[model samples]
Each structure stands twice: as C-alpha cells, then as structure tokens.
Target: MLADSSSSLAHGHKGRTGLVRILFATRHSLAGLRAAYTGENAFRQEIWAASVMLPLALWLGQGWVEKALLMGAVLLVLIVELLNSAIEATVDRVSMELHELSKRAKDLASAAVFLSLVLCGGVWLAALWHRFVPG
Candidate 1:
C-alpha cells in the first residue's frame, strides 16, 4: 500500500533520478518549446519578436542592469506565453466538448499573456525613452 501510494504521488513510474532525470528533463523542456513554437502562433510570433528585441536590448541598454531588465521583460512575455499554451493544452486535453470552466481557464491564461505583453511593451518603451528622449 505504501509503495502504491508512493507511485501515485510520483504520478506513475516512481519518477526519474540522477543523470537520467536531468537528461529527460532537458529533452522534455526542448520538446515543450518546439511544440509551443510549432502549434502556437502567438508563441511563434513572440519568439520572432524576442529574437529582435533581445539583441536590440543589449545594443540599446547603457549598463548591465539596464540590459538585464530589458532582456528579463522580453523573457517574461515568453514565459507567460508558454504557461498560457500549457493551460490551453490541458483544457483541451480534458475535453473538447464546450465547457464553461475550460473557457474560463483558457481566457484567464490568455489575459495573463496579454498582460505580459503589455508589461514587455512598457519596459521597452521606458528603456528607449530613457535612452533617446532628452530629460
């Protein structure tokens, strides 16, 4: 009974360990990125934006802290998008038949992504304004 309970806690297979777990985790992380890039158009779009903004952030930023903040803001958007995608995937996986709770979850996730985008935009604008605009 203890063994059964432990296995259940591990969510089946008793979980991975040591180097094997590290390798598995890396692979799973890459797969999640690939799936989000391929399946989620918004994620793909954000990736493209990040590709541009990340380098620009470095070039435009005056100091290490500024650059880090710029990069972090962009990364936050990506992180939120991934989480939103995961939420959407989980909701869909549970059932395709229209349901209110599923809609609520998905909508909330989407709103999170939108807010992340807004935050990213605000950060970039502030950085650019600080650099280019005379104060």
Candidate 2:
C-alpha cells in the first residue's frame, strides 16, 4: 500500500508538469498567430496587388528606379494602413463612447489612409505611362 501511494504521487506530479508544458506551448502559439495576423492583412493585400502589377510594372516602368518606386509606394500604403489601424485601436481602447476627439482622430487617420492609397495609385499610373509610353 505504501509503495502504491508513493507511485501515485509521482504520477500526479508528472501529470501536472505535462499540463503546464501544454499550456505554455499553447500560449506561445496564440501570441505568434496574433502577431502574424496583425501584419498578415497588409502583406496579403500587397502581395495580391503585386501579383496583378508586377508584370505590368516590369514591362511598363522606365527603369529600375521606376520599378522600385512603384513597389515602394505599395509598401508605403501598407505601412500607413497599419498605422491607421493602430490609431483606431488606441482610440477605441481609450474610450468606447462617441467623443468628439475620438471621432476626429479616427477620421484623420482614415484620411491619411486615403491619401496614401491615392499616392499609390498616382505612382502606379505614372510608372505605367513612363514605361509603356514615355512623354
């Protein structure tokens, strides 16, 4: 009876250790996934856009500089979008109410996103024109 009780206690300790290990692994995995998702949206969208534009830019861009600028514009838009998201998140965390300052801040962040998108479009058009049919 004594030996059996001692073995049971050791078994219980092992069980506890295993549970802790599993929990730690799960936590790390979740944190990694959250981080990946945070950046994944921008990366996925930009890559999709590139899939459409890479060939066109390669053919239509005036030179390496033009190609670089076109790609860089897309990256810049993504950066701005991420920043805008961060701003909205921060505002929401600060307060969920309909405050004037929160509204203004979100609106401003949205405007910045729009401006970056517009710049991206303008760069693409310019690069395409310069590459396909220069002035």
Would you estimate the TM-scores of all the predictions?
A: 0.89, 0.62
Quantify all predictions' global Cα lDDT against the true fold.
0.91, 0.75
What residue runs in model 2 are displaced by over 4 Å at the alpha carbon?
1-47, 54-56
lDDT of 2 by residue, 63-95 (tens): 798878877787777677767777887898989
> Judged by lDDT, which candidate is best?
1
What digit string (tens of lDDT, one per residue) describes model 1 on residues 35-121?
999999999999999999999999988999989999999999999999999999889898998999999999999999999889988
Best candidate according to TM-score: 1
Considering summed lDDT, which 10 consecutive residues are worst modelled in model 1? 5-14
Q: What is residue 119's positional error in candidate 2, in angstroms?
A: 0.7
